[model samples]
Target: MSKSVPSFLQNELSGSVMTMYSGDYGGVEVQGNIQFSINYVQKLREFHIFVAQCRDLAAVDPKRGRSDPYVKSYLVPDKAKIGKRKTSVKKKTLNPIFNELLRYRLRMEHLRTQTLILSVWHHDTFGRNSFLGEVDVDLSKWDFDHTQMNYLALKSRPTSSLQPSDDRGEMKLAIRFLPQVSHSPGKDPPSNKGEVHIWVKDCKNLPLIRGATINPYVKCFVLPDMSRKSRQKTRVLRSTVEPVFNHTMVYDGFRQEDLKEACVELTVWDRDKLASNLLGGLRLGPGTGRSYGALVNWMDSNADEVALWERMMTSPNEWVEDVLPLRMLTTAKTVMK
Candidate 1:
């Protein structure tokens, strides 16, 4: 009986194999399940799994080429002998299934070239303390760090430092999301759930080998009064969720040939007990708007692509940037008032 794995992971692994199997002579292929541990290959699979999940978040199918060229496996070819009569080595051709996988790999590589702007939101503890987040990065910068140095060593460079611009095109990313206090909004909502969707142009838009995580179950303390100590003075609180994020850092072929856009429905919950206690229900904090403000400032001040900031603001659909106004930049640090 065959087991089932998620489509996202399948896309991710396919992309990884494409990234690693590059060479001048010919391409590499996978055969039977048995072999020495292909640790690098496994890493590629894990990264795609994460990419698939994020694609789900954005409601995009980042693995669009799954049905295009197809994928297949074959036995490794034996090397030609020196002394014996040279045998005619008929180059093996890719079956339709394998071609689909190859096409997916190429497509993802293209996406890896185009930079994606990721907007991440953190509804800390509860819905009351919601804050904004985003990452503007170019996927062209990605590469194997170790591989770069080794290549540099062969050339006898005085130094083998990998400069930001060197492979920054592969995936140069940055993230900023404000911590907040909020309450749990039960599963259902009047409209869409409080959650936000996330999608990347390609695997390079992600950080590393797998998906990111948000730790929502941690505990904390909220004090009614700092100096006045009494039974009512302290309250147990839910801490910020620790998120584990990952994506395909590299691909075996150009993006257009291999990967697809990924999508997911947002699933954030409201759980701000502190705000509930004070406001009788969940309410936005005074400084909450500042999160977007700071993001805009960063985009204007730090992003090389200024049009990204502008495009985000004008998106017709209420995108993440739309909810996070660029003017929230004026808030002084931490003074939520």
Candidate 2:
């Protein structure tokens, strides 16, 4: 089946935005293929791939049917900001020649758990970047001596056989904690109580349902209280995987100290008229252990989750934001473990 036209959203405050869904890779001629050569530079203990070119790339600009193409590479699971390397953008071309080298410095042991990812994207000037198709090669299965130019057909992001399914998508979340009752512009007075503002900006590359149609929404719960009063959700945005819900959810009547025992869980769901399915979610708090004098599994978060939570808790009255990747939440129950 051919892919549908991508959704274009523009915030007057922020100008034009570019978004591409996971389903955009349906048509081979449109989503396209990337040419590259991979080799291990043994002398420097570095792995490098030369992004040769991208052919028949998708036209991100629906009106013009044009694409400003670029190639980006990452060592899987470490798709962190610092880990990705990109080629210069070739303006308004479906077939762009980059001929750029992207390298990764690591040891032999690290390669055991790594996968080489080469993704082509359409660069949008004003707002957010859009994803095209990609090709993944598990490093553990590759031969370092094979350095011939590889012509591989690109496809949507593939689930890794090496690791558990964690790449559902990414959510842009901005959190602010008002630790005290204070006067701030465009903010609630809290009536002598502290407040937590959850800014659900948007999501990118959300999981696709059948026919590439999804009515996605964001669901939130402030934990230990999984009651109806504690649950809040955003309006479902139809069709697009990159749904922008620039809405804020506010919770009050808590003391500054209470944040230590609190956990904020944000989940992304595909809202069907009949039933909604949980795509993925994230839990933000200090981490696994006792919360409110009780141990719970839902509060179990690590790395980026704990860091983001601590950043918000420490910076009172300031927005502490981060783009956290959504992970597979195992359980359906909202109760404590």
lDDT of 1 by residue, 186-294 (tens): 6533232121112221111111111232112111111111111211111222332222222212111111111111111111221343332110001111111112112
| RMSD of candidates 1 onward, in order | 23.4, 12.2
Give the residue spans of candidate 2 off by over 4 A: 1-167, 182-193, 331-337
- The lDDT leader among the candidates is 2
**In candidate 1, which residue ranges exceed 4 Å CA deviation?**
1-159, 163-301, 318-337
- TM-score to native of every candidate shown: 0.17, 0.58
**How many pairs of residues collide in each model?**
95, 0
Least accurate stretch of 10 residues (summed lDDT) in model 2? 8-17
Which 10 consecutive residues of model 1 have the lowest summed lDDT? 78-87
